[model samples]
Target: MKESFNKNDYGFWNSPFQAKDLASKSISFTDLFIDNGVVYWGESRPDEKGRNVIVSMHPDGSIQDETPPEFSVGTMVHGYGGGAFLVKENQLYFANSKDGMVYHKNLNTKEINPVTFPFEGRFADFSLDSKRKFLYCLRKNDSTQNQFPPTEIVRINLVTKETEVLFTGSDFYSNPSVSPDGKKLCWLQWNHPNMPWDNNELFVADISSENIITNSKKILNSSVGACYQPIWSPKNELFVTFDGNNYWNIYKIVNDSFEIILEKKSDFGRPMWISGTRTFSFLQEDILIVTFCDNGMWKTGKIYLKNNGFVEINNNLSTIYNIAADNNQFVMFAGNSLLALAVVSSNIKEPFKFKILRKSLDDSFPSNYISEPKEIEFTARDNKSVYAFYYPPFNPEYLKDENNLPPLIVKIHGGPTANVDCLMNPKIQYYTSRGFAYLEVNYRGSTGFGRSYREELKGKWGIKDVEDCLDAVKYLIQKNLVNKDKVILAGSSSGGYTLLSTLVKNNKFLCASCTYGIADLIAMTEHIHKFEAYYDQSLIGGSILTDKELYFNRSPINSANEIKTPIIFFHGDKDPVVNVKQTEKIATALKENNIYHEVYIFSGEGHGFKKAESIVKVLDKELKFFQKYLSN
Candidate 1:
């Protein structure tokens, strides 16, 4: 292990974790589950042009890629897809990214067949009926002219090879969890003007012998708050996480009333950004293996239904994703700041004893070369508390002058609704290992915190989020931890909005990088996808019609003349969200204003860069841009 700290190390130390490792070697695992003693997950390979391959691990610890190279296991449902695949009785069903059709693969025979015809729409959040004769999922129809599409819970008859719409009325539907006995069906639904995390309803219906859904009734209406992950227990009981008391807690629907199963100050549920996100799984009829966010860190535990008691499972992992119960054990993808993301499993009784099935980064670096983050809470401009993770410069091999301070990199996470955790992110480590002081600001509006804090950015979108980012830098500079003149701003998506807004509002940083970020809120509202059509309305105070001035005024593109800091923008020409034109328009305005700026449009890339070459180019250019500006 390399020594963790050496105050003598220079500020611009060299790191072995180069941009190549970050782009090509650091793998990302998502949508994990287990079936019939086999662990399965969606592995994204940058080297393969960001192809998502379905991988499976057998009981004997044998691993193999299940999907063929031509077939990438992904979907475009709701624009941001998840729950792309499911397995049953050796039959693998997955949505193909190329055609938006669901495919079936016989694990035994390795024969691939298309289950659904090619269409403009997509299918996700897959669920199978009791007899496996029908597949249930949320089917999104994108042919509509409206930005928001008409989504329905549909059942596909496997024997007949036909699709049947089971339920339709809501603007969006997800999490179609059939009862273990197959007699009842439960799912979540929310309409326009309200995002899933803002407000949604949970419904349950009786399933007829003929496979028709009837007697549909709302079981829980989150009119005041939000609800997520409605799942059925082994004994046919229904449970979900509700954020009625500011914090998302586990609740059980009993006699038409929600009974708190476990109450905590932390959030048991996260923002419903994608489909098929599972935070908890039933290990048995009365036990649940779960993960929750506590103070920005995700922790796993066991919940006893009968006693409403909980026991913290000491798995060293601070970030856990896509958990599924497998017999008496649970399998998941999890890792912390110092650990690489891996496919891990543990017995319900001994949940801490993790068995690593696979690792994204197989090779480990010297301990001293890594810089660990320290969680910090600072007061915002409004006196509200803002949380961030601070990582100081660390390089054991080099030494720096005692009087000098390191340059700062303020990383703002996207989502505006999402929060960052202590994950082993190769991207963050890429800069920190090179002696940059990194800070990830969990601004108000970010999840993981209580509902009140998360809602603070509502109606204040660009304003408060921008304030928090600026406040974080001011706090660091006041503490003498970072040089104010050498600070760099970086963010993507909504975070990019905050970055550009900050640069326009104040000139506290040297240079900044924006990736597929929003520059014109007005244009974004017009080009926004169906899933988040109304997201800006809630965040920015009102719709385009109601608050047109606010939209134009909050947009960074409108105030490009106010920006003096140099910036480099990376955007995907085919991005569905935050149209590439947003970046182009802003760059044009900057050019007219004679402000230093550059824009790189990558071909075939989208909201997030997936190709290794694109990732490498962005990082390489960003490093040089920041270094050049810092030196000046």
Candidate 2:
């Protein structure tokens, strides 16, 4: 008789109605729009205005609310800076980075108008080309202007409010699409030593009719892989989704060659970059539905092209987030582990019709204190295979007995080629409910398996993600489920540079933590940020003045006097991506090599950790620094 889920039985363990009250008791579906005959989504309501207001559901069903603007006191920075509606002809157009302006409602006179651009940036993809009267937009520049440059691809002129700069990116620009006679303009670029699923570039241009940008082309660059979402097929052809031979398939561009149309092993990009959405949804005239990433969930299928086949239509959707379609219906933003909205109808025996619009919390936590992860698969030291999630410590209020077995940690996910899924992250359930047993590790340069396992971490980033995170901590202490002297190891920026290069080149991490990570890969290729300033020429290859000893032998503060574990860190004194002097030069080389380390810093935060008492004081100071050195 042990059953107790607390924090008001279920609401406050880092609330937001805990993934919409676990997606309304697990039926799931939310925020996936298409207006009028109804479909509009965004939900997560338990009050204090963290998320909610914006709901609709018709198509002979009937349901409409749209209740935003309430929880005042800086309402979570104005509902996390709202705006992203765009429903043409019925007029909606949105992008109110909390009144930075670009509004225009009407849905039949619900009335609202705002538009007055001068660019304070962050309004991605809007198009009204209406035969070039112009209104094209796609701005991002998250300016703090340390000498201006972060991301851009502008265009605005709803009849001369004028603003141009068709392309100006040192890295990052996404899904611009446009071209059903808009005179061509595709997008999607990546730089930063790489991460857009590890490599990206699709780009296309030639517009001018006074919208400018008359010639530009890079149409698909690959030096071995990574290309991303760049759609444009309604008979204009020019689709894309690369990771060529390592698996993320779907390519088109006929006559000029580049053909594969849907190969698979999973992942179709999207772990970041939302807004200006579109995951292959052409709908009719020979159908094509697309959305991929299989094992780490999120799936959607249906690409017939007269029988080239692939009919998956939804395989237990898990936090889809967006996908819209026409030719008779299809609107998802799905959910199963909470996050909602689903509707499907192309008559393939219709039945999917959900509408949970945000549940925000009710079951009061206690599926044994929430810890359900298991995807595991190991192999790596170049033998390859690697993929992980693990998690294990079922917390009956943090109890453990039958011969104790918990202390583990590991983690490492910061685009060391990202891939940690099964969303609902209470910061990884506040450390397996407190007994602790995590893992995460999607090593081998992670990115949903394909493209030769993301080029096996090219020239091996800090030696293949620190030898596949020490062979997943020696396959979890040889399956004893962790306890080989309480192993630890965490990560942040580049998984905090592979947790200080695996505790200064392994002795089996008995301690290590990081955030705003990276400790000098030649001073992060001379001051990071310029979209990864040529990411050490593709993961540490040379040019720290031509590979200064492979950037000081793959920096961990140049082997911090060969560490010896105990490291903990966390930064953010305005961290513009891994720089708080890379954790104060590894806390001054763990205090001139006498070793034992710990550092904090936050103030005004940046590079991750946005308020809410700095994410509950950085997860309660990394759970009291892993219970002061793994509990003993």
Candidate 3:
């Protein structure tokens, strides 16, 4: 048995981690919560046709699927759905993706019932008021009223099946949190031209006996910089994660004044891309467990209320999410380089150790096969520092050839606002274990570093982000870490725009792959979801009316003729974020110019690919494209 575990020479590019296996074995966990000692979470399974199932773990250490096979728990409230399910007592309420209806399931009797009818628009971020027998949530309005849908905070009577709009003037709404006593409610809202992370306000209102919202006032004003995750502690005090000082820190409202609890130059909040994002939980009246981003790496820790002292918990997790606490115990979705993303639980007294309730992927593979990322910083073209996570080639069975440098895969994360951490991502491993050095760039505009860093790409979207990617590649090549001639570029969504923009400015990469990337900034500004309706306005520094020329000049579609590298384009026809026309237009131009390229438009996919077959097909196509152009 020991001899069988020994390394063998299979060489790079012949990795056992095939794309088909990764697609089938991979699971995405989200929206975690704990109730009555039962830990529940949502799992999006690719192998099951992207069916999202609600799973539960009992104290007896038994795990079971709470969602029926006929239903998929998901929502389209923000196009990037979240907070799809919530639990109260023995009832599980979730939004079914197939018909966009909210359903209530009796956990004990296993009887499913629809609570909301179709045409009521989509809903997410649910908060149950058991005393009032009402379910509060954020709902998107039908598009019939306007091109971009408006969002509202609404409450539905659990008994009468009637929904009442609690508030409506905002362009977007999320995080409808009911107070512990169910006598008050708080939520986050922002107007157009501002993302939830860019600039949003938190408001609180007292509920009347007639269920009317009374004395509704903005608790945390918009000027306080983007506020997120308005959660009430067990003591019923209103709290939020504020970024007023550039770093997201936990702040509690004490007599109309914001008091920072455990002040640190780290982000205790994340961008509200999806609904129901929780980063901190009160384990007790005084001790709080928080997942914070410290220097781009995520860490879980405990904050003592007595003196605002913090102590990091020692767990085998680099990234943490959806933290929920009950008394001394807390559960969350956490993972690190050696461990796959899983539902883990730990107590306040035993923070150093945790038990994995469920894993997103099988971690039975040999530990030696894992390639841990090294967080690196380098000077960019603009002379500012850029951050990235570099994963060197590692295959237990394969030995490196000192004479030759490995090909490099430089990735640009989407959301020009999003940041990538040292999590155990199978896609990154698939390339690294196959003799490829993977560089995941957390460009200037990415979150977690600080608000200033996140706002770096504002008005200079194409320039700053593209330069950072170029600088990262230059830094890696100059360090003799990767083969200069074999560097490849890849990105999706906004990252894809960066990839395309980078290709236009330089001819460094041998080839590139872009998935659902924006090609025409002007077109995108004219047609996109309300969540990002004004996203390009901030990115371009002005609206289309004021910056038409900048939009045209910065858009990669207009400069498609300048790109000399062979690129493959992948897009979803049903993408609500970046229109499929974005990719199709660029491909048409490339074909017209006789540039070597391939285009694949997956059916029934949104901004991101979810179906296992689609993911497998895309990965296979990408690997084949890279191998065809990779030079030794």
Segments of candidate 3 deviating more than 4 angstroms: 1-12, 143-145, 220-223
Better of 2 and 3 by lDDT: 3
lDDT of 1 by residue, 139-201 (tens): 887666555778888888777778888888888888998888899998888898898988888
Q: Which should have the higher TM-score, number 2 or number 3?
A: 3
lDDT by residue (281-391, candidate 2, tens digit) is 667656777777765666777788766588776456554656766544666655543322334333234524444434333446444466667778877666767878787
**Residue 282, candidate 1: C-alpha displacement in angstroms:** 1.0
What is candidate 1's TM-score against the reference? 0.96
lDDT of 2: 0.63
- Write one digit per residue (lDDT tens) for candidate 3, span 509-552: 78999999989998887678877888888888887997699889
- TM-scores for all candidates: the values are 0.96, 0.31, 0.96
Give me the displacement of residue 129 in model 3, in angstroms.
1.1
Candidate 1 wrongly placed segments (more than 4 Å): 1-11, 130-132, 143-147, 221-223
**Cα lDDT listed for each candidate:** 0.86, 0.63, 0.85
**Candidate 1 whole-model C-alpha lDDT, 0 to 1:** 0.86
